[model samples]
Target: MCAFIKVSIATFAVCNRISKVLGFDDYKFIATPVVLLMLSFSIFVTQNTMESHFSISNIWQYYSFPFEAIIPFVVFIVAEIRRKRTKVL
Candidate 1:
């Protein structure tokens, strides 16, 4: 699917960027295998991964709440404060 392809490309780009950040330029070739391995691992972790992924459970909801909600809100508030401070100057 298009979304999967986009995610895979993003993952590969992230891996390349990370390698550069870590001063591992010569190891760029390793990124492709690592990303593919991780993606495959995620897909085959359980028997019903794709099926169960759609049906959110309470535990996942609780675990993801701060990340999916709080962090973005905090970032937005911080950006707003900075914007207002800049406007006042």
Candidate 2:
């Protein structure tokens, strides 16, 4: 229930980008389609095959290592350089 609410509100915020005042009716309008789409996508991705699960995990592992581990160090180095130039610390 909590997860559904969080995801729905996030979907609503992303979809409701128009620069005008909208009320609860507008929210429901956007949220209803988002919820439907989420349900449909869940149905589509529900494969019980172990091969599919293994392939998905392999792809995530391949990408997650360099991006998750190395990118943080690069960001920290860049921030440190900027901080040194400004003498903030």
TM-score for candidate 2, please give it: 0.49
The alpha-carbon deviation from the true structure for residue 63 of candidate 2, after best TM-score superposition, in angstroms, is 1.4
Instruction: Write the residue-wise lDDT of candidate 1 on 3-69 in tens digits.
Output: 8999878777777777788789665686777778876876776457555675456357887999999
Q: Which candidate has the highest lDDT of all?
A: 1
Q: Supply candidate 2's per-residue lDDT for 89.
A: 53
Off by over 4 Å in 1: 24-28, 36-56
Candidate 2 lDDT? 0.73
TM-score of each: 0.60, 0.49
Residue pairs with colliding backbones in model 2 are none
Per-residue C-alpha lDDT of model 2 across residues 1-89, encoded as one tens digit per residue: 99989986778675675313544435556666766887797667765667568867787688688999899999999998998989965
